[model samples]
Target: MENAEPFHDTRGFFDKIGSRIGSQAPAVAHHINPTDALLLLQNYEESEQGWFWSTDAAGNLTYITEAIASVLGGGSRALLGKSMVSLFHKTAEGDAGSRTLPFILTKKMKFNSLEVKAAASQDECWLSISGRPHHDRSGNFLGFRGSGIDVTAQRRLSLDTARLAMFDSLTGLANRASMAKKLETTLTAYRQQKRTCAVMLVDLDRFKQINDTLGHPAGDALLKQVAERLLKVVGQGGEVCRLGGDEFQIMLPDCDDRGILGDLASKIIGSLSQPYSVEGNRCIIGASVGMAISPFDGLTSEDLVKSADLALYEAKGNGRGRFRFYSKDMQQSAEDRRLLEEDLRDAIAQGALELAYQPIVNAKSNIVEGFEALVRWNHPERGHISPGLFIPIAEDANLIWELGEWAIRQACADAAKWPGKARVAVNVSPIQFANDLFPGVIDAALGASGLASERLELEITEGVFMAETNETNAMFQALKGRNVRLALDDFGTGYSSLSYLQTAPFDKIKIDQSFVRGATEPGSRNGAIITAIVALAEALGMDTTAEGIETLDEFELIRNLQVSHVQGFVYSKAVSQQVLLENLEDGQWKIEPSGPAHHRNDRLSMYRKVRMIHENHVYSIVIRNLSVTGALIDGLYDVPVGTKFVIDFGEGQLALATVTRSNGSLQGIQFETRLVSDGNGGLCTSRRVSPYLIAEAGLDVPNLPAGYVPTTKIERDSLSLPAFSTVADWTPTKARPK
Candidate 1:
């Protein structure tokens, strides 16, 4: 620092300081001299309140204070010859009360608190600088004289505060407010570019169970792990966010293909449903996804989010661990579900539910060994609703315990009146098994109905063992103490652990219907899986029952595999108690296995009204039986084989088919493209006609409940003649047609 040339001589520096202080002081302070002023300035430098510097007319540093020189290292010699702009740069791009130091110096202007950073420092170093252009006595520009103070700590604190406002502290993902802002901004910009975007809403299932059982700290750890997995699947493809408390949202830009979206949703569900290790405890949870596409679903952010939320509600309602795409009818479906929840509560109060028993028969002798009790609901207006529809509804509404307890007592009373030694199996839900008082419910039901405990079997799935805590083991022991039988239901479908089988006192292992239904297919591993399960059951002294045996081939394969029992439509569907009593009036009821000789495509029978278009002529048709590959229709008469028609299922779904068979008013048609699963045990088209295209075709898209027709426009004229006669009086039978 001493080798550098000073900008001011000692005499001139003292003279300037004395003149400034004398002008500002009163007459009594005139005794202050240049030597006194120079000593005072030296004292100020030693205090280290701030630093001072000067540059020549060419912007080369000429003088620097000792404190500033030492902080910059290499003393004053290294810094004196360096350009002022090269030594420091603007601290950041944007800030209040700040300007570029280079701009201020180039313009020869006075500035206050211009923040700059050291260009050569390894660590972050900030300085708030104030400077003025100094000129010679002739008014010629000489150089810049400046003062600076360290402000690095204040800058860092401000940056940290800004980050906290936009991110979640626990998971380190974008918060709700940040996500909302991003969605709004993106949509506003993309609307002008004619682009597409998609949104997915993911909700974690059974998270509360883990949270309540293990503790909050473990739950937090599990959430962090979930965030990591989501990032793995959606890397650089979209923005994944935490919407607080087990819910997450993802924004995918420039994607509108339903096939691609569905694949992503499935991947997310599978990844999240895997087991997590939290604090040395294994935890299992599931995820449900709902997706919505751009202009097709909605144009605005609010509408898109609402559509995604409705789809999420539908996905959860159908059953957790699945994904669903938004359709126009979902709004109505959600409202209907809300109404049905109320009706279910009333049904429980009025005792309007009843039990139907499906017999589980011996594979060799064909004699009934037991019956699994299934609940049936007959709504006054809707008629026989499927159990798949209402069971999930009951669970979500907190009505499962009430409905399940009623089922146990009702099954016991019904089984007591039977005239045989046949057992009755009742399904025990995970919610019921978790309650400590559930064993007492079982004991009371057996005592009140006077049914032997040995005749009542509780069917439990793998979900009850998710936690593997003492409570689960204690519940199993308590049931066993009552001399009741326990059957592991839906085996090989979930976490099939051989370790649990050894500890759990299970009397039987019921093979899941999924494996049985496909075991007879060509080149299927299900057959080998079934064989291994049977061998394992035999070794463990547990009886095995194969479920869903609907064909002779399946039944024969199961029998040859040495399965102890069989339960499915091959013997019979669930029958009412009165019918069961009539069959069991004589001791030892036996039946022969009678069903289709070969397995064919499983079709669902319905009387739904649809549209069939042939050569621009639209005709109303009623679907008799529907399957993924084809359907039977009753409307057009005398339609010859090989006639092509487009069938319109409502809500933008369309299928192209050709008539394969014709018999009177019935015509069987085969679809050109196979349908996909709708995630609710139903078939739907893989893609739908967008509403944007429908609007361009001169139709009110919002008011119509159907899709577009690609054929020439229909024009009613006097010369037009119908190709096929219409059957106006045809009606289906009261029973579902075969």
Candidate 2:
């Protein structure tokens, strides 16, 4: 041991190793034996691993190991006494550098491994490290001591496994499983925070068609392009996942407002509408999207997904290429409709339906000219449900023919009690007309009621004749041959034209009430339309009835248009058969014309009173056969001289005249300056006054035969009262008898 040079060199090497270890060791381990630490370091360097050491208060290398550097490279000597920075090559400064070392020291991390270039050879090396804070048994902190190993190959293998599990190889998007997990986590957080979010389920509208027509590879390429576009649209806050072939799902975590989802859906539709070049061929594809929101459409992930799927179905049903939101009412209505459809099939068998008649009246006469048979249902449990609710159900169930036949028979039976003049207007459903037995059903109904076929009017909408084929035309002709009047109900509502009226052979066109109700407004479109319709019908030799004429003004308007008939609530609502019969028997069946002829012989009739004074011979007479235009003064006797007379007309109208001569029992007088007033301050126009002149000599006043009627009849019979000239030869003279 005395002054051995090899021993000194060995001690120097050990001391240098200790100094390097001292620099890196945590302070809490400094008090450990240096020899023991050296042994530990030697053992670590010999093994295929790495370790770091630190000093204690005695300035000894309390912790030492060199296994990590040996594993990272080839030898521990390359790492011994090298600063922690030296493990990194110059080219890999970002992986291991002063910046990272400071972070490790300040964090007091036990260890960390990073890939870096070796300072000695400038070659890349992978290192794995672990570190823990050095502390005494009492937990007094000193410094950090750690160990590390290089595991770059192991890391690469793990990364490959993760990529295979979470991503789609073709689209490079998160797979369904990963997306589901992410959605579940996000939904949980959203539920806890009471926040809103939206999930969009997107299904390509015609991906299968593309795959069929083009090729599967082309379809796959299109899907990849679609994924890229979706991601571009969704941006960072949202996640897009490929659920399966041609189906993608998007989860927008913080999207509380559904309007954003709508916007996104629109974008998706627009983007998909553009042609995509796939495998050198341009391909067009469409997409349908369904969106479900948190706490509105659903409360959980499953509920949301299910609701979205249902909405997607709805979108597809609505011709696809659109988006729909999940609505509880929609689902409920669909379910209700299904149940009602099933019940409707049985309802017909159970006779739950009935028909009631509402009177369609003549506007002028206020008489029920026809009955509009409206169907009603007396549901066993629901009691008196409207036909609007159940008739649609029957139609959907394909039970319309049965229901329509029943309604026809019931209406016919009810109409028989009404006046024979009154028509029974049975509404024919469009669905019933699709069957070949429609005409036969009408025949059966008329036969059952024993009612005259002429009294039955079949009412159908204008749409019935639209797109009419030869078969439909033949059916109509057969019905018409049985004396049934065909009325196009709700005319002017749908595709109404003069050509239809001419071609359909309709007996009448019922103008819809929308026009009739507004008819009173002068210069209104309704007035013009109604007038045109009436004119058209007249031109076609068809009767036109205005429906929904509820007001007196509307009645007047329709009457002015000369519409044949009108019906509305103004007359009465639908009633039972007994009520209708009673109403008919109550003598309310008078047909009043729409004019002033209702009161006969009540117009003003006038007769003239005449008086004559001839040289102290006073004569009194009366005029007969007075009309609005002229009169005749008859009962007068002969007078010896010319006399002035005044004649009084009713309503304070009078005239003055002079008797030029007389016959045996009559005298003729000339109207002298026709009086302007009738002595009662009422102005008399010339049209109400007439004049006469004497045309014969005097008659014997004393020897006049009693009660002798005039033999010669003048056009103006009043002129024969005396010797009067006809108004045709009479002329006005400017003179007053003095």
RMSD (CA, Å), candidate 1 to true, equals 5.2
Best by TM-score: 1
Clashes of each: 0, 26
Off by over 4 Å in 2: 1-339, 516-524, 586-738
Residues 159-264, candidate 2, lDDT per residue (tens digit)? 7789869998889999999988888888778755756667889998556656865668878888989998999888896889999898999988767444456667
lDDT per residue (tens digit) for residues 1-738 in model 1: 112345443344445557767675666744666567777776676677777777887788877666766666557666776788887654555654444566678889998887777766678787777888888667888888877887888989888888778888889999888998999889878766757789999999889999998899999999999999999999999999999999999999988766677778888988887778899887778899988877667778888988999889999998778888888889999989998899999999999999999999999999998999999999999998777778889999999999999999999999999987899999999999999989999998999999999999999988787667888899999999999999999997675778889999999999998898768889999889999999999999999999989999999999999999999999999999999999999957798999998887879899989999777477899999989899999987778899999998976677899999999889999999887766556677777665555566444556322453333432467324557767874445322111
Q: In candidate 1, how many Å is residue 516 off? A: 2.6
lDDT of 2 at 559: 83
**How high a TM-score does candidate 2 get?**
0.39
